[model samples]
Target: MSCEETQEQVSLLIDAELEEPHQVALFRHLEGCCECRLFFDSMLRFSKAAKRDLEEIRLVADDILPLHGPLPVSVRAAGDGANSLPMHPSGLTGRRSHRRASEDAVGALPDRRSGWGWKRWTGLLAGGWRMPAPVAIGLALVLLVAGALVGTRISTIAGGGGPMGRDGRVVKPTVVVVCSLPEVQVLGSASRL
Candidate 1:
């Protein structure tokens, strides 16, 4: 067997998961190959060190926590309650307390119950409006169609005659010719010398 295959089987053997035949083969390879034997030895040492470290960590964690269970009283409320928010048993503050504080600071604002206007529309946009799947699809289609119409109108107005003209005809390309007889005569005179 190759050293690579032996090393893999060594790991499985350490975990006691390798088959009997594979284990015998791995041992025979380890006996013949010095490098494979060294690799197996190092892996065994690393596995033992890892297990020891994990055990130490588990012991430390067990000592840190109370033997009985978690404390019933809130840790935040254990000290003076002067500046601390009253925490619920589940560790969340009551909504009413938050609402009261906000109301006192900002005072009462005017209620906006009017139909969809700029302010309401902007607020909905800012807050991220969630439409139904069908509504979202329909809106996307409408926007796409409007964008295409706008693009077509802009291209027509710009007079590049893109694709089709306003008359629904394919516009022909226009070419202009320039005469350079003066420069050609200068070149002909130079060539004669």
Candidate 2:
């Protein structure tokens, strides 16, 4: 087989996906061709080195901070106060910790749980409680239906008139008829009437 084909087969063989017949052909070519043999060896070495490096990195990371357990008390305390940890020059570890700190600061307000007031209502809304999707949809539908009904009822009561009167009856607009004439003639006609 050509060197290019042999190289492709070598990759498939490394992945353990090459068929037995292709493997035998590749081995025969590798035995006859020195360049192909060197290519296959280098690929094997590179793969092994990469795997070894990954294992070393995983070990070092586990030693620094365990994956399963809680963080050290020092790390936890460092995140709690305004003082910055020595390891981190900035007072914040990440956006999440910063947000938590801000939330805690806001929650330090005076107690208002004893009475029903605007403060209590706002507190409930800010506490991250969420209405269920179905309930929210139902509420929207109810408001829409009620608004439509009220609008139609008011329009029917008012009819085509300008507006509803104090006694709930439609008030018709007044019609004015104007007659244009010379000023002296209009005065003379009014005097005759």
Output the number of the TM-score-best candidate.
Answer: 2
User: What is the lDDT, from 0 to 100, of the residue 188 in candidate 2?
Assistant: 14
| Per-model TM values vs. the true structure | 0.34, 0.35
The Cα error of candidate 1 at residue 109, in Å, is: 60
Please give the lDDT score for candidate 2.
0.58
Model 2: lDDT of residue 14: 95
For model 1, the run of ten residues with the poorest summed lDDT: 184-193
Q: Candidate 2 residues 60-85, lDDT tens each? A: 54345432226687765544443322
Each candidate's root-mean-square deviation in Å? 28.7, 23.3
RMSD of 1: 28.7
lDDT of 1 by residue, 1-193 (tens): 8888888888888899999978877888888899999999999999999988975665554335332234445633342132333345554333344444445346433333434655555445334554444544555565556556556646664785545656676554322222232111111111110
Stretches of candidate 2 exceeding 4 Å from the true structure: 65-193
**Whole-model lDDT, candidate 1?**
0.56
For residue 143, model 1's alpha carbon misses the true position, in angstroms, by 97
Model 2 residue pairs with clashes: none
